[model samples]
Target: MPIIDTHCHLDNIQYQDDVDTVIQTALNEGIEAILIPGADPKDLPRAKMLAEKYPEVYFAAGVHPYDCENYDLDILKTYITHPKCIAVGECGLDYFRLPEDEIEKAENIALQKKIFIDQINFAKDVKKPLIVHIRDASDDSKTILMQHNAKEVGGVLHCFNASEHLLPLSEHNFYFSVGGVITFKNAKKLVDILPKIPLNKLIVETDGPYLTPHPFRGTRNEPKYTNNVVTKISEILSMSKSEVSKLTTENAKKLFKEFDIKN
Candidate 1:
């Protein structure tokens, strides 16, 4: 079955020693495409370079919520025009880890919202979809997305961990992607909600070098682990792996139209 690991950080330092090997292994493992999402502003250049190096690889350009400090939108804009830069994010609100001080926390949240909104507008301007990252702030994220009329281009809720309350966003052109976290034994919440998510609105990913799936939770994740993600989703949905893979791959291509799956 063909697969697309829609959110991986191949340019991260963890894979610096053997990114070539990692890409080849992922390809050999039947991954048809891999998207490297930008987190820090400085990483976009390297992400762009990697996308250029591999025809099967693509990337997005944006600053992650945590990295929103002193973000330079100018740099992001410069790369957003790159043919290989398929989306505008990996950008959204993540209140999971915030400053301990009340004042700092409030300030941080505000900054996150600002940057997220800016990226949303950037996506609109470029006529590209977003790759949103929301955690511990799904309500706020949903509100902001709605307020900005982000559905004009649509996007995926990468590594989706929000409440079922936000599931209705499917009508607004929002899709979801699950990662190794779904394979965890204690991921009961996510597992229970798995089937609830419309299959066509779901895609599989491996947030590589992090969230390694069960039985390999301690090791750094790689794109090849995407197969494990597909298998688990199959088990949860009571469907064959191939069926899940094909549908998810199609869903991914549908969201990321730049993939050119015909090749």
Candidate 2:
């Protein structure tokens, strides 16, 4: 069985010249495929191009919450339904850095909710899954997702660090994407919480260009190092490396399919 990087930004500008090496590293690492998540409209075209270049790279198209604050989805919406755009997201709310003014929070939440609903319905209408990005706004994210009937077109909370108690959000139907952070000594809270998640509800990622795991910590991350994520998840679950690899690879194919992949 081969590993699958469930979430990574191989489309990031940092990889332009070195992409081939990065991808080759994935292949050599027994990584069978990757879901290159689009961070914003600016990255979607490059994401599609990279997916086309790599036989194993699939992609999604949508705006990240941080970047989506000033969005004009109409333009991106047209191209979002393209064949290579298998999902709509990396989109959601981020109240972590925002002020707690009720009015301000409400306004941002409203905007986030609108985009989330729009993207969910677009995903439902276009017939694709979603790739969600939620940070410090888990409550709002869950609330709006439920209100929009997000379960109709299921997705994942990519690069998640929420508590185990919040796993019920997946009950409404979503997978939890675990990344390299779970391996760190300082992430004991997350590590202690993650094993409680059932294997079927989990997916692995690098979220690269970030979250480099231990030993490799403090360095830039990439899809090639997604194995570090799997290795740690395997340790937490007390499962074999091959088990985690096979299960997550199947999990990835189940959520997002592509022509190049023999789904």
lDDT (Cα, tens digit) per residue for candidate 1, span 1-263: 79999999998999999999999999999999999998997887788889988999999998888789857889988998999899998899999899999999999999999889999999999999999998888789899999999999999999557479779888889898999999998899999888889888999899998999988999999999999999999998899999989999999999999997545
Clashing residue pairs, backbone N/CA/C < 3 A, model 2: none
- Pick the TM-score winner: 1
Write down the lDDT that model 2 would get.
Answer: 0.78
Query: How many residue pairs in model 1 have overlapping backbones?
Result: 0
Give every collision pair in model 1.
none
